[model samples]
Target: MISTVVWGTGNVGRAAIRAVDAHPALKLTAVLVHNPDKVGRDAGQLCGLTHELGITATDDIDAVLAAGPTAVVYAASGDIRPDEALADITRAISAGAVVVTPALYPLYDQRNAPPEFRDPVLAAVADGGGSLFVSGVDPGWGNDVLPLLISGLGTTIDAIRCQEIFDYSTYDQEDSVRYLVGMGQPMDYQPLMLVETVPTMVWGGQIRLMARALGVQLDEIRETSDRRPLDATVSTRTMGEFAAGTQGAVRFEVQGIVQGEPRIVIEHVTRIHPSCAPDWPAPPGGGDGAHRVVIEGRPRIEVTVEATDEGENRSAGGNATAVGRLVGAIDWLVGAEPGLYDALDIPLRPAVGKLGRKQS
Candidate 1:
């Protein structure tokens, strides 16, 4: 069994702990948390599971790495503190622990990642003979594995489109919703996520990954965005209120152009409230959110994945899928050579031996 450490205990980290506990090939070692109150809590209980996982949570990073974990699941939030996330992940890798995470966006396609982000990670991998892989839902499999797999059914391909349609009203991250996404803010306020070139910085790597897999040369990548205002003031159960004329919905596309035409695209249609954008694409199954792929070809195939957890919370459901992808690869990485890996390098393996396992 690969002894593993789960860092961070927020939205993503909670799911990681549960996943590691359930995986037969993985051994849960330690959990690191930022909240002082969370320290010294049982790992499973901290994540809302009824049974104790026999491991406890701590805030000491030095102690975690000192144990010489075979692998680490770095599930901390990188949205606000990417630099700190990078430093932490690098430190884990430098200590000879294979690390997998959804934190770093650039390293999703580490080959084309900026030198500033990729260089330091490579050095860490070299220094301690450890491996690293960075990916999440949209930049994870939504745009890469799911689309590529669905495209196989097509004969003549025109354009491949991957979409994430989500309703953020029930999403628990209020700061990310109100300020970072400019949801309750005035229409004039541009959220940090939807600003110029920022979409490219985040989702652009997935486009490049898809293009490379299809053996197509991209001329360039481009972006198009649109925002809609709430028709009126809206109150959500989790987030207090969204004033009328405030930013309600956001739609954007990151396009990979081939032969001067956009052949590969990654699009997101996010709404603070369901009533925000009626015209924009919404979730297909009428859930909180979904990751969809549209293959425009002779067959014109489309696939939608709607996952919900923690009482049908789509955000938590999505986080669980990401945790499954990253945690499931620990055994494989433990046996492989120490190096940086990407989505293409990792195969989406099936739950081969988990058929009859008891719930944690």
Candidate 2:
């Protein structure tokens, strides 16, 4: 079995730990955490997976590296310490561990990232004689993989757009609300909120990734965001955060250009208001919710992915999907060609069937 170590103990990190535990071909060797409260605790318990895997969490990266694991999954916070996480990946790679991460920033959108962070990451992997790859549902697959999948059906394309719409009523408020809908005192406190440089970092790379896969060289890319309030309070008892009414909605649209000409347009919408779903009614299939992807132009494809769980746990569905993908790739990532890679660089086949197979 391929030994693996996971960095971080947050939502994504815990999810990665669970994925590592369940995979037959991979082993959860160690977990790295920065929080003093979390260090030395059972990895499984940290993620609510008590009685599953018995590995403990530690803060020592070098000690974990000395254990001889072949890979490390970097799931640390993308907002606060992205640079530090990148540094950790650099150290792990230097210690001969292949690195895969779900950190938010980085080069998910090459056009939006600072060269200081991006260039060093690439250089570190090359210097360490190891490889690195990063992915997650939104930037990883929703925008990047979905558009690329649709492109496979078209002979010629005019524009490509991918959207993810879901109720944020169940998400962790402190962690996701401000970043997603800009919640504080007034609805407009952070007016033009989602339009900031930070949000752009998440989806920008996906646009570039799709453009490159379609063989389109983008000359320039531009982004815009919109928000509106809700009619009734949306509450998450688990997170203890509520909005008197829908606080606002946020949408990001990136237009891609090729040779001074527009080629593809990618848009992402996150809304706190309920009115946004008037025409496209929310899927009543239950659970947290689902998202629809509608691709226009040659070989048109319309698909909807529904959530399978309910309430605060709705994220479990998407988290499980991401975890399974990460775990399934352990073998290939550890031994394949080294360098930074996105989902587009890897084949979609052979993904773990636990979450359900990808639709054709």
Candidate 3:
């Protein structure tokens, strides 16, 4: 069994713990957390399971690395403290741990990554003989593997569009929703997330990844964004009040142009409240959220995936799938030579031996 460590105990971290524990070939060894209150908590409690898993959370990073764990799931939030997250990950990699994470946006497409982001991690892998895989749903399997796999069904393909439609009010992240994305804020308040080139910096790699897989040379990448204001003030259960005329929904796309046309597209329909954007595409059955792929081709194929976890939260469901993709890859990375990898290199294998199984 590959001894595994889960770093961070947030939304993504909770799912990572559960995924690692349930996997057949993985051993849950430790969990690292930044909060002192979480330090001695059982893994089960941290991840919402009723019973303890006999593993305690720790803030001692050096001790965790000294244990020489074979793998680690870095589920910490990199949105705010990206450099620190990178430091934590590189430190772990240099200790010879096969690390996988949804953090690190620049490395999502390793080949296209900037030298500054690429060089240090490569040096780390060489120093300690470890491998790294970076991926998530938006710039992750939703675009990389899912679209590429489904595009195969088309006799002739046109544009490949991957979409994430979600209602973020149920999403637990308040500051991110209100401040970063400008939800519930006045239209004049420009969000840092939607600033020029930020969308390109984030989702542009996914466009490149799909283009490479399809063997299409991208002439350039493009970005398009639209925002809508709430018609009336609103109040959410988790977050308090959203004033009338405040920003409520956002739609953006990063498009890959090939031969003067967009060949691959990654679109997001994110709404703070369901009633915010009526015309924008929404989750099927008007549920919380979904990841969808629309392949404009001979078969006109479309696929929608909806996942719910942690008390039927769609956001948690998406996080769990991201964890599934990363955690399921631990055993494979253990056997492969230490290096860097991406969604393109990592095969999306089904749950081979996990069916009808009971968790320990």
Best by lDDT: 3
What is candidate 2's lDDT per residue for 1-360, written digit by digit as tens? 888898887767767887777676777899999989998898878877537467888998778888767888877866656667777777887777787777745566534457786677678777777777777654356667766776678766666666566555555445556653564235556643364664446656776777777777778777666555655556554455445543545555766767775556656555443454444445445434555566676667777765443234655566656655666666788778777666766666554544652211
Go through the candidates in order and give the C-alpha RMSD of each one to the true structure.
1.2, 4.0, 1.2
lDDT per residue as tens, model 1, 1-360: 889999988888898999998899999999999999999999989887889989989999998899899999998888888899999999999999999999998888899999989999999999988999888744378878889888889999999999889888988779988888888888888799988898888888888888889999999999998999999999998888899998999998999999999889998999988888898898865678998899998999988898987888997888889888899889989988999998899989999779999875
Worst 10 residues of 2 by lDDT: 351-360
lDDT of 2: 0.65
Prediction 3 TM-score vs. true: 0.98
Model 3, 1-360: lDDT tens digits are 899999998888998999998998999999999989999989999999878999999999999999999999998888877789888999999999999998888888899998888999999999999999999644378988989999998999999999999988788779889998999889999988889888888888788888888998999988889999999888887898898899999999888999999889899999988899899999999888999999998989999999998888898898888889999888888989999998888888889779997764
Local error of candidate 3 at 86, Å? Answer: 1.2
TM-scores of all candidate predictions against the true structure: 0.97, 0.85, 0.98
TM-score rank order: 3, 1, 2
Residue 353 miss distance in model 1 (angstroms): 1.6
